[model samples]
Target chain A: MTALPDTTGKKLGLVIDLDTCVGCQACATSCKEWNTQGYSAPMTDRDPRGSDPDGPWLNRIHGYEIEPESGHDSRVVHFPRSCLHCETPACVTVCPTGASYKRAEDGIVLINPDTCIGCKLCSWACPYGAREYDVDHGVMKKCTLCVDRIYNENLEPEDRQPACVKACPTGARHFGDLGDPGSAVSQLVLERGGFDLLPEMGYKPTNKYLPPRTKRNTPQAGIEALPKGDGSAMDRLFKLADRLLSGAGN
Target chain B: MNPAYSVIFFTTASGAGYGLLALLGLTGARMGHAPSLLFAILTLIIALGLITAGLLSSTLHLGRPERAWRALSQWRTSWLSREGVAAIVTYPFALAFGLVWSGLVAIPDAVAPLGILTAILALTTVFTTGKIYATLTTIRAWNQPLTVPIYLFFALASGGALHWAISTILGMEPGTVPPVAGFALLMLAMLKLRYWGLIDNAPRDRTMANATGLGEHVRQWEVPHTSTNFVQREMGFVVARRHAQRLRKIFFLLLLLAGGLEGAATSVPAFAVPAALILLIAAWLERWLFFAEGEHVVTLFYGNPNA
Candidate 1:
């Protein structure tokens, strides 16, 4: 263990602006471009030109559509996921080889690839599944939050930010030293009501997400006061089948 | 969750090895094969080789390899640690048994007869490995009591098929293994049927809200980011129900035919060996699907939870 002081008092994290996020995959693409060339086996892809092609990428966006069964516009939300660099990383604790560890200074979860045996037990123990198996190195991989870029003294001080933060065309991501409460990222979180993803998992993810904006037209009386819609063909079919199954067929 | 092939191979290959070791125990091969001691030693070597390779493969997935020993410290609480310990303990006994089989050492001719005891000990290793997965309470799919027995049976069937195939290729003397392979395959079929039944009767109740804990009836309205993260890459995979159903059918037929071939191979060695090889491949796929299809309860939070 490097035994970096409990920078817990000063080690900062990210706060994602979900409301402003446009579901664009710029961050993912930039992350892949940076990490692949900069670290490990490029999170290698097999048969990139072939039909069964897949590659290891540290970031991805998921699209979700939430619509009322009654009448409402679907709320589409896009979530980008990475390692979170949690304050309490389960992945680090469960790692047998000390290959996985948390930097006490910044609370960044890192895997020392040299000792990684690739047992993948850490993956199972993780609810977030933050670790990816790097086939080329025969070791596990994860997002380092552009560790190479963030702290590189060779780079211009202005360039000392994560690749995803730099590439984000939308101002949805903030990178900063979370240790400073007055930092723009921290203030944004406090003002925006940012919440942790899956707080119940107890990993204490360093990244936070601004909650979805509540719609104004939604009624309060459960299903009764909600606007109605004509049943879709499948919905109509299911309703009839449900009636029959409930023994009210006649 | 990234389905590291190495770990998969380790668990699966070792499972078959342990299963074969178990079969060697159960069939009354309790004593030395004397003249065939070389064959026994070769077989044990192959078995141990596969097991060690598997262990090696699992470590390859770790971000830090040097800290692998820390896993052993958790045997009291972790099934993974127990697996490590169980695997190590079986070796000394196995080496001694090998010596007894080769007539290099005398068994005092009294204590639990080396043959049966060796067989039982080998099977114990397999049982322990299977239990490693079955004992995890956090992953509902793996936590089932049935998982241990199923893994044991499948391991035997898989190893038996592989053993028969290899033997024929090498043109070894036709030992009384085909029938045993057949028996193992039959048991595997029954085990698979039971496993499918168990899952059906208790399909997971994972919900978006329950998983994410954002609300009582949570649904994925949006993902907050645009990049693939740990959760999605590992737990996000899904096999179409229709495709899974088809695979299950194919799996059943493959095992059934392989069993039949093993039984008939006693009279027709040619057919049995090829069928056994095919059976081995099918079992590997079965094992792969078993892990792939299993849903982690944590998926409820990220959405696209398991069935």
Candidate 2:
């Protein structure tokens, strides 16, 4: 069962826009809130009230300072990392108990807590560090892409997205069938030249990231240019100040 | 990458156990006179005990120790499962070989076949253990061609040292075992040194830019969390250069002294136990370094992208 399926009929995945992400952490927090109570409940904190607090979280946001290079300006990029639901997920195949598996229907990688021995090899196999070991329950927990919400009939069609996508204040996260070339997300990827993270590792990640857009030349705000003077403004001002001081002394 | 002691012990102990089992299987049936029943029984007990202890210790780190049995069911795709299966399968053959060697069983002809079977299974188990780490592309340090040979050679050397110790204790002619063990030790030392060199000089292919799909000049200004997370704890192990160098020197010295002592056992006959003990310690240190120095690609996200 650990052998990956030949193909998933639909590659459901996310497309994130770095240019739009505000790094507010709403997506990460909402993801934690939802998943903590959802499929992988009680993502327990080992020392919630102590000096060194740690816990399982499905999503994490990292901020990077991209230095100016060539013609591009410097910018801070907020990167939200989660499981990419790779077409060839090493995490899934490395599971010794068949506890970790990818859904053949949608390519969403998930861990079956009932079968998991919590050996943690799956976490080591992941290049993105997507899986979190839940110490309290002794199971591996990860982003299920809100499988409970996404497929629930109780939710409205528009509200059926993953919690991270729904909670993104900047509309930075998009979820759809990435396998379909004509999907809106796919089109956005095409237009923005979205790229896969760590493509050289060759997991063939389903998710994509839209790179930050290049900065454009613009005038500074709230500042006015000084009037031109032939005498040179700084020199004239110094001379005027000197004359005033001399007159006062006389 | 955190070099959990439980796993380190598991690998080293099991590696030595399997190596001893393999060597016994290869040589047991061919001896001119059957080894003393006590020697045979004691050898089997030590080898099997180490393997069992190692396996039990490995379960200590698991989140659910009771569910460890399920790990053997996924041999179709998982190297861990394969390792478990190989180990389990080797047990019956190894037990049979022990019985036959001790003359507890009536069939003398069964020794050769059982020994060969046990040897093959032991080698398979070790190979699967090596593959468990080597197949993980996420860890550049472990996912290499050198990993398998290193595992095999270390097992051989440590196991050889144990075998030599037993032979010397039983008052067997020292000429028979020490030479082979000395040779294995030399090979293990060379391979280990080469592996270290390879990892030290290897170019890191995973970078921050590629990891985030950002540009080449990207540098982490802030990590995802203010405190350490699971990923950081599991895969973000860092070793200071000075400490690592010191450990390496110790490891090398211990291994070399073990080899020298084992070789000297042929003349002095008193150095065998010390050699075995030193070899075990050396193997432990080597295994520790294997895990401590390994850099997982996932650590790139935590401002150590270059590591």
Candidate 3:
């Protein structure tokens, strides 16, 4: 089996286009299904057969209704939160057992389950809450960025993608080498002004987010003077004339 | 910062055991208690053992056992590291104290050379335990200015209780146990009351809007993700305000019964021995809730209600 080019010596990451994301939750559902059975440790939901249920899951999406400007209609931006695979992951440095570490090769933060003690200290250290305790196995787990799948060469090159990226029906999630400026993900980021979450925390997140953009054409200046459809024909005509004048800054 | 029941008991119980011993070693020079030497030695060991066991149990949760030494190197930045260092340094001093104790010998005019070691070690142990809590900036409950003082008080209270209990068990008269036990209980009560007040007045840092970091007047209509993730499970733990109030009441009752037992006791030995143990458990419960009730600063980011 031909191995994909070494992601080593490069920082691999995701560029999530928030503008296009529909918040269908397809990515989250697909992730749970794939990682649960496919990955070594599935998210254990305690009390699944009853109420007061709690368990460990790797990726969680936080929904926010953001009204950035005052007196504006709110928009729900589906924030699919996961480990950003930071350049300097707080979780990595805080791990006492060296179980949690940022791969020197790819910059993807990963947990070496053998070394983890499940102290959950690494979880507390992380501001993103990316780490979860696998109660069944007694270890911390997180998004591997599909390190297992992305590099696997057994499947077609196009088929190799992170489960979340694969399952994103809206095509909001992109995976590639962020280091290369010419890469599709990188170019998209550069063009759209993708940003990192909680930038001030200074983890230097590898993942980037494309900001939400407004819809429709640029309205002419003073376009608000134009009257909406009304019953008074003469009044509407006069308002149109006024709008034309205001459009020219008269 | 769950403040696992075991750890809560371990730290407070162990701190008191060791802390009182350190005190006994320091004042052994002036006091005429026969077991001053014996108690001090036993306590130093007990404290060291408590700390060792706590450290060991904490490590049991780690994925990598062999790499434990790497943790100590990060003391400059990590509280866990600082805690480890302080504990290790204190252990040797504590051990040296027990070893060099000459108070056990017939020549008891002046105190042993180890008294100084003990005083330093006791202070160190108390600070280390407190630092462990104070370092957690995420848990608003623990990440307070009061964590250190509360820890110090517990150590004293537990030590007082342990001293009271041990002295009573050993048939030490009122000359030692009552005053220390009384002082310990009072100090412990004061700290608990102050902590209760601190939490009551603990101002909320974020509203729903500020937490989402979108605007000042924001409300979460829907969560972005379909499945639950780590942040929600870990940082988003919010205890109901009513439960917190109920907890406060229980804290008050326990404090009254446990911390106030010494003054109500008819006999120092008879009352102190049992009462101190009861209060230790109460102090422990208080510590656990202090952790569980603590709201992490990060919880605000997700629009979770502040506890």
Candidate number of the best TM-score: 2
lDDT of 1 by residue, A89-178 (tens): 656655544667777667777777666667666666666556777766667788887888999999999878888898888878899866
Residues forming the 10-long window of minimal summed lDDT in candidate 2 chain A: A214-223
| Deviation from native of the Cα of residue B244 in model 3, angstroms | 2.6
Error of 1 at B119 (Å): 5.6
DockQ of 1: 0.16
First chain TM-score in every candidate?
Answer: 0.80, 0.87, 0.79
Q: What is the DockQ of each candidate?
A: 0.16, 0.69, 0.18
> What is the Cα-based TM-score of model 3?
0.73
Taking the tens digit of each residue's C-alpha lDDT, what string does model 1 give over B1-307? Answer: 3454766777787777766555454432433344355666676787678777777776655554566775665454445666776777767766666676555665535223555665566566667667666744436666687787777777777777767766666667446666676776777788778887886678566555443333443466655433444455666665666877898998888877787777677677677577866776776778777776677655654666533
The prediction achieving the highest DockQ against the true structure is 2
Highest lDDT: which candidate? 2
Which run of 10 residues does model 1 chain B get worst, by summed lDDT? B26-35
Worst 10 residues of 3 chain A by lDDT: A1-10
- Give the distance in Å from residue B19's predicted Cα in candidate 1 to where it truly belongs: 2.7
Model 2 clash pairs are: none
